[model samples]
Target: MILSPYLILLIPVLYLIGWIYWFLKHKRPSLNMPRIISFHKISNTPELGGTFNTVKQFESFIRFLKMNGYKTARIDKILAEPEEKEILIFFDDAYENIYNEAFPIMKECGLTGVLCPVAGYIGKKNLWDRGLKRFRHMNENQLKEMSEAGFEIISHSMSHSDMRRLNKESLIKETTESKRTLENLLNKKIDYFIYPFGLYNENVKNAVKNAGYRAAFASYNEKNDKIDSFAIGRNTMYIIDSKFDLKIILERKPLFLFGHEDQKGRIINWFSRFSAVIKI
Candidate 1:
């Protein structure tokens, strides 16, 4: 095939146009500080969960965080003053594989993470993900072992139900009961809560706060000029994500990171004003 001279000349022009678009789109006067991130199921298998990352990938990702000098979530991670390059890592759905697979890697990397588990389902299979694969939660003994190893254990919920779909009574039960159960089992204060499926509303956030949690995690760090600890949003890690994706997220310099979602995100933002009941 003969290359056309006109096409060759247009290549650099197109590249410049793409670069300019990205530069403007990702330009932020200030970045979101003290990063908060979430991950789940550090396994080699993909069928376990959508965010299931391979063990090798997990190790590499943690190493990158450590290289950048990101701090692990200590007891006062939320209340303390933000250190240089601050970050908090959260692991959801307390799969036993995390204890077996991720714990050692974290220890080797000299890092830690908060593990969120369904309080009522400790030592039992994840009934919520029963349709995927039969994965067990870390038993009480395992939970204690990880705690002794210096990993924080927090409440996911009683049964991992969507908080937005629950009534006020049910929402309270889910948040408060789970915290009570974990505290009783671990014999320590459970300070944080992560909403299941990344679903929440003002009511749900109020319930989490009333339940004695210092903070709660939801999915996607949308624009929150005033950061509310109760509904603190997080970016979900998927099996397909790369080192570049991790870099953009941790640095809070999203250039080409979310470029594919630009169109869809704009459409949603356009209708957001009209949808009084829907909260992003």
Candidate 2:
């Protein structure tokens, strides 16, 4: 595919504007406060969908974080110590691949991750999603072992439905019952919530807060005016991301330094919106 002359000429203009925007934004005290990265699967599965990271990529990224003096911590710790090199690692969907692959790697680095599993899908394959490469969600035993090993297991949702489209009664159950389900299974308090598909509104946030979750996380799609713990946003990690892409993502990097791959990430993230339309 070749770019048209008009589109080609317009690219630099867009970057110039984006650069100005980036400069003004970062010139302040700093806008890269909540540095959280969310991952789906941690396997070398073959698929057109670039969701899972290979074991090698996962290990390299973790090694890069350690080399840069970063430590994985809970969201609460990250918030309390704002200036520290603390990051929150999230393994959304709680796939068995994550337990089999990412768990040991993180342990080797003396870091832990927060696991957000769909309460109803535990011990079952991800039939709710629209994909050819279906994967299994961690069973109760796998989840329990990780929780005992110091990984935090929290609610992704009861059935992993879109919260923005649910009714009041269904909304309440998704937030409240899911937490109850996980707490009973893990025998520990489930404090935080990660919105399925990263979709939520005021009602969703209120429901989560009322459900006894001290904080909740949204994906990159939802932009917040400030860091609202109930609606905090997290960066998503894709298969194509490299160490340099991760650097630009960790900080609100300069415009001139932002590369084409980073721009591709922004475009790819648009696919997340498809979740509202389909099970994917």
Best prediction by TM-score: 2
Per lDDT, the best of the predicted structures is 2
Q: Relative to the unseen true structure, what is the C-alpha lDDT of residue 30 in candidate 2, on a scale of 0 to 100? A: 38
Per-residue error for 8 in candidate 1, Å, reads: 18
- Against the hidden reference, what TM-scores do the models get? 0.78, 0.87
C-alpha-based local distance difference test score of model 2: 0.78
Residue-wise C-alpha lDDT for candidate 1, range 1-280, written one tens digit per residue: 9889999999878866765664465433134444666677777765423557788888888888888877786746543565657777788888899998989988988888788888888999865542246678889999998988888888888977767888999998999899988888889999888877767888988899888888877664444344556666555566767777777776655544444333223333233223322332
Regions more than 4 Å wrong, model 2: 1-6, 15-32, 221-225, 255-266
Q: Write model 2 residue lDDT over 1-280, tens digit each, in one string.
A: 9989999999889977865664455332235457788788888875345667899999999999989998887667776666557888899899999988998888899988889999999989886555557799999999999999888887898998878899999989998889989999999999989888777889998899888898888774233235667777666778888888888767645535543433455566556445324633
Q: Point out the worst 10-residue segment of candidate 1 by lDDT.
A: 271-280
